[model samples]
Target: MIVAATPADYADRPLYAPIAPMLRRFPDGLPDLATLQRLLEASAPQAVSGGGRPVRFVPPDDALPAYEARIHASGEVPTRAGDWHDFFNALAWCVWPLAKSACNALHVRELAAREAAGLPGRGSRRDALTQFDECGIVVVTTDAEIPALLAAHAWEAVFWQRRAALRETTRFLVFGHGSWDQLRQPFFGLCAKAIHRVVDPAWLRLPAAERQTETDAWLAAQLAATLPTLTPRAFSPLPLLGIPGVTPDSEQADYYRDTRQFRPRRA
Candidate 1:
């Protein structure tokens, strides 16, 4: 029977499947921006060295410069922060607070260093890191060889031929909602490739209790030095099957098979 599906049928599709596991941490699933705001308001103030500040969500009306300044000064990632673009950022922080803190702290230091050095403005590294913090992918791997393959853009080897190895060796942690949305309706030609930072696999092998501490230390070290370099590796064809919970047929796959976006590097 070729019955047409309705909107209600598609409603079951998860909006942000990449973070479905992390979303479970909330117990209450992902809350809307308004609901998230009320919850933050109800929470107790964060204890600071000099007393504490009551935690509150940054209103959508706040100017961007002001919001950035507040976070930079306070070293706090606001809950339900910013608008639709950054709502996923709040969720990311909830999922990986240590990592998010490490990222923010690094950015602040980079900005300060630039000011101290009398650099004209933001450095390339800072801009790159900021792009990463806004919408980056952390590819944590157990094997040393995987990173090289990733850097080389060996999509087939890393994602297909050695697919089983990927499940065992790599962990993809997505941070930005922009990244999340792209994963949902991926298009090879869109040029929306994520910023990739590969975490050493050895860190993951540590005891669960020590993993966060070790990872935080690693992040801090990387920040103190150079931020990870980003490269574009948009899939030649969107890897729909590779994505969890996405079961697109050939027709659906055709959507991302556009030659404009998926043009081969070799003529």
Candidate 2:
């Protein structure tokens, strides 16, 4: 009959075809771990980076039950727009706020490449974490910051799992945000079993020592060439000399606990 479909009619179309079936997969026709993961994998699937690593689009099984509980608990299951956004919200909450975002993959992979090339990189990169928060920046701080940082470390474990799959990486400096001067006093003695070299914020504050050192000059020069956004304000030692300053961790391991323990002490 060549029926004319109006805007409302057109809007009724599903963003994904199998969504209804997926939603119905559980015993009582509710959400299931497999379907939720499948939806995430299909919608914004992540690919292997630098042409080295197994494809990982699906959320790990451990992550799925938690995701299902969130949406069902939140009661935000979308019948109008599409089920995927609900799924996206779930992933964002379960992982990072930006897990569905393409930039999550793009930014991490791009940063990884720069680090592999032996360039200067920032560690304790909490700003990257803040980018996902509702409040863009915090003029002042609060107790909530520690939880947020812990959450970031948890997601970082998943991200690092994907890092080992990356083949082209040789070196890169990865860190989150902290303060300007409080390094040794606040940074703790970060000597470790997994990642040995931790850069203290105070080390960067030392100028006279840096100019005279060979390591400082090379790192300064490399970081400049690699990342234009993060120019060094002062000289700092390379944290990834013998051990990787910011080695990505495996998603399926004790990596989350291992990771959060090392994140630069929060302000």
Candidate 3:
């Protein structure tokens, strides 16, 4: 329930910081299908569906094939008009076209494999893919310890003890449209499934736009190579509020002590 009348309404919100570049494209109001298609063309000319067809945004319709199937069989993405979730999804495609297509391709492959095996429902691989699609965050950093701490659920160690180091070395990029939608009204319990990438420290010095572009390319390649063996275990849960500076409350050491959100790692 984000009720923003226009993209600009939420542009300055801290949670929307990751997608600010996409938001800037639509200043006046929510983008229509045509506008989205145009933006896609401009931003990612080579962008295609899982089946290699050119990607295009389209209004939602019952007559269309199942969501992922349609994107795989045809390039049309069913988008709901004026919906925050769908808008962020389209923006995700624009920003991370190759990665998104790889995800769609993985979904199609998983679905086909399940059918061939006579499985009646989605399998674990598909579930993991969907979970990441809905709430994934990419944590790119030069420091290996940051991710290691995160994997161990060492909240204070990662967010507080290494706060300055993280600011200088890591970049958290949101890849989940569902997470983006939920961030519209951030809650203390909001968390994301993070996949970490240890990049060269030189990347930290690149301009903001270049950094994002580089990340998009790197992520696409990583997904293409790893999707076959990817699983839920590959992700580490990160409570959004515990991230330093994500919220003002997080600046206080007490914020990380909230056991309700920053639960201890299981024995």
Please list the C-alpha lDDT of all candidates, in the order they appear: 0.47, 0.29, 0.84
Per-residue lDDT over 1-267 for candidate 3, one digit per residue giving the tens place of the 0 to 100 score: 355666877767655666786787777888888888888898889899989989989888898689999999989999998888999999899888878898899899889988998998887778788888889889989999888898888998888888899888887888999988887778769999988999887988888778878887887788768867878876789898777666777787777888899988888
CA displacement after TM-score superposition, residue 179 of candidate 1 (Å): 0.6
In model 3, state the lDDT of residue 41: 91
**Model 2 residue-pair collision total:** 14
Candidate 1 local lDDT, 16-66, one digit each (tens): 433453344344334566555443343212211111222234544454443
**What TM-score, to 2 decimals, does candidate 1 have?**
0.62
- For all predicted structures, in order, the TM-scores are 0.62, 0.22, 0.93
| Better structure of 1 and 3 per TM-score | 3
Clashing pairs for model 1 are 189-261
**Where does candidate 3 clash, by residue pair?**
none
lDDT of 2 by residue, 1-267 (tens): 122122122122221111222333333322444555465455335422222222232333443433223222332222212233233333332222122222233345455665897767534332332232211111111222322432333334323343352212222212211210111122322221111122333443545224123232343243334333432212222212112222332233454344334354334
Give the deviation of candidate 2 from the true structure as CA RMSD.
21.9
- Name the better of 1 and 3 by lDDT: 3
Model 2: CA > 4 A from native: 1-30, 41-101, 117-126, 133-267
